[model samples]
Target: MSTKELINNIDSFVSTDVWSPLDPYKDEKIIFQKGDGAYIWDINGKRYVDFINGKGSILLGHNDSDINQLLIESISNKSSTVTGPHQYIVALSEIILRDLKRDHYKIAYFSTGTEAVKASVNMVRMASKKSIILSSGYHGWDPLWYHDNGPHELNKNDILDVFFVPDLLKRAITNNKGNIAAFVISPDYVYLSEKTYNELFSICREHEIYIICDDVKQGYRYRSGNSLEMVGERADLYVFAKGLSNGNRLSCVVGPEQVMEFSRDFTYTSYYELLPYISALGTLKKMRNQNGYMQIRNIGATFLNNLREILKNSPIDMNVNGNGNLFQFVFPNDEIEEKFYRLCLLNGLLFFNGDNQCPNLAITNEVYDFVLKVITQVIEQLSSNYNTGSFSINDERRFISAWRQMDGASDFIDTSDRLIIINKLFSE
Candidate 1:
């Protein structure tokens, strides 16, 4: 189909908001209607290597035998819920709890990541006996008490009293002191290890502050059992979602029984009837049976490191930054970024723009190697033509001025300053 037609079709569904016709995606809409393994097919039936990985949920690849079989079995068995018990539910939760070996942690099956997140914060507040929270996280939107994400632009529910840095905790403590309830951070996929995880955990521990680690996007990327096991003794509550079920809607909350289980004061209830429970259960089983994490994670790491080698001399400052098996790319600037994107499109390679979210995965050895070759080729092509960098200081000022003109941002972000930050982070 023509670009105009694609744009029209998308506009029909999303006239406004993020997916609206005014967005950048309006021009790039591929309208992929089908996917299998690492390839997704657009409306015009063009197949591309899906690096976006259904925004990181397609790690098992489009339709794997195991996930597909379990999904079909779920339909075949019909759905069930509880205040009662089911064997598969018991078994799945057991696997999660068992592998992690945290006797105090309890697992719940949620319909979405944000749902799990909302539930977690509510629990933390209930146990902390405090009103405010200090967070260094990109948790999902829920109205609690937000101090970041720039105020009301994302809605009050999504905002919770969150602090983006540990220093903020210091500043807040002087003013608010014991009033602060919790400190939340994503130990994985969190920007700059120098700043976030280890230090935040230590501070939270020292202060006796509640630590909530949001691992929604990074969990199960490499390890199945409590993905932030590396957080190392500071988190009072832990949350994970992204890799829990590939594309299946499954998220989990597990932490110290001392804090999480005490949230009985607040109501945390889901209908508890979801087919994805079985999907998640079966996923754990399959991973167990195949030793999936061990095999696939090693494969993924090797693949990523090889790409880094290929791009070693490229003028564009690209960094392959991630842990275990998760994948993401950072680019120098907008012009180079646009060029990288076009090259991927022409060769049918896929990757996200900003965070690159989670790069999709190949479940099998053969599929992984084939696509890795294509990606290697694409990187080589991009490297040869690499013209370096996005968002000039002037452009940053324009965006700021435009937003300010249209009322204003609740959060204070110096765009000119951020330009420097982004550049420094991407530089090897």
Candidate 2:
């Protein structure tokens, strides 16, 4: 069937119009058929560079040969699932522990980052004997961590929200003292500073509240280990997913034995699935052998630097946020952001518009250059339209409206100066 027909059929039965927050463009959605490396093909056989990268879950990029082979082997061996623990799980656990450099820390498996986060929160609550959790950044879709305006009604008193400001965090801690169980942080290193994280960690430590580092999105991209190690701080619990098994369904919550022992009470049937274990093992081994993390970091750095330089001279007033491997474009107005999104889509570049652009290991220098070229063209076209006084004020507002309704839309503000200064100090 054609793309439109398939979409129509999906609309007939699918409960929602879009699957995830990353899928914002409902009216102009591209029905992707297949992906290889950094690119994906639509039902019409058109190719586009995929910067979304499975919403940052694809560590080695789509259809990685080693990961594919390992998956095939596991399936052929009829070891994809078993009644009990298996060798693949043990091997993968060993590698994870070694990378963490903390042998005493225990791990509990889950199928998604959301589940891992939920498990971590539950463990912390049980261990600390407190119900209140002060959180920052996006944790997951679970109602326990959702904002006050989330789709479902929230308890309002359970999970309190705070920004990166030290004073704000301190006040929240002071007000909720003794009742606070844990401070859950899903660090967005782009806007967050190591100093701030250290201060927050120190506060949580002082109050004896467990620190749960929700590294679901940022994990495995910056380095092989957890974000705590990278930032020179530690957490009582760590949640990892996304890039765990490239694109396979796997997530893990790791912590000291004292806290992780609570996970046994929350057993899941599919937690011990064998294919994801094998996939994670292969992905981690390949990443270490090839030094893939450094390469991804370098690629991201180059792309961000070059893009920043290009944007500096453009007539458009777009701001760029994030590090080398993961970043985003912040537009001054919704109209221009919408225009840029549609233009890039029209020109065979699929950026995670209104969110992050997750560059993968498969995005080589050449691919990045092509992506930059397309972005430049899009910017130039946008500038030309504005210069000629032909820019559309009547452009459809649905996409931008949907994006604003999402949780991270608060980041759309112009904080270029603060972000640049923080990033500069961070690099040094």
Winning candidate number (lDDT): 2
- Per-residue lDDT tens digits for candidate 1, residues 1-428, read 67667668666777545442112344566566788876878777887776667557666677777788877776777655545446766776777677667666776556677877767877777777776665554565554534334431222443333234455456655666676677766544323344345665676677787777676766666667655665454356667777767687778777777666755543234435555677676666666676766676677677667777766755545666554356555555555555666666666766565444344445455655665677566667766664343222343433333221111211234434543433333352
Tens-digit lDDT string for candidate 2 (161-224): 6545455568878887788888888876665557778888888888888888888888887888
Q: How does each model score on TM-score?
A: 0.78, 0.88
Tell me model 1's lDDT, rounded to 2 decimals: 0.59
**Steric clashes per prediction:** 16, 2
Misplaced by over 4 Å in model 2 are 17-24, 149-157, 387-428
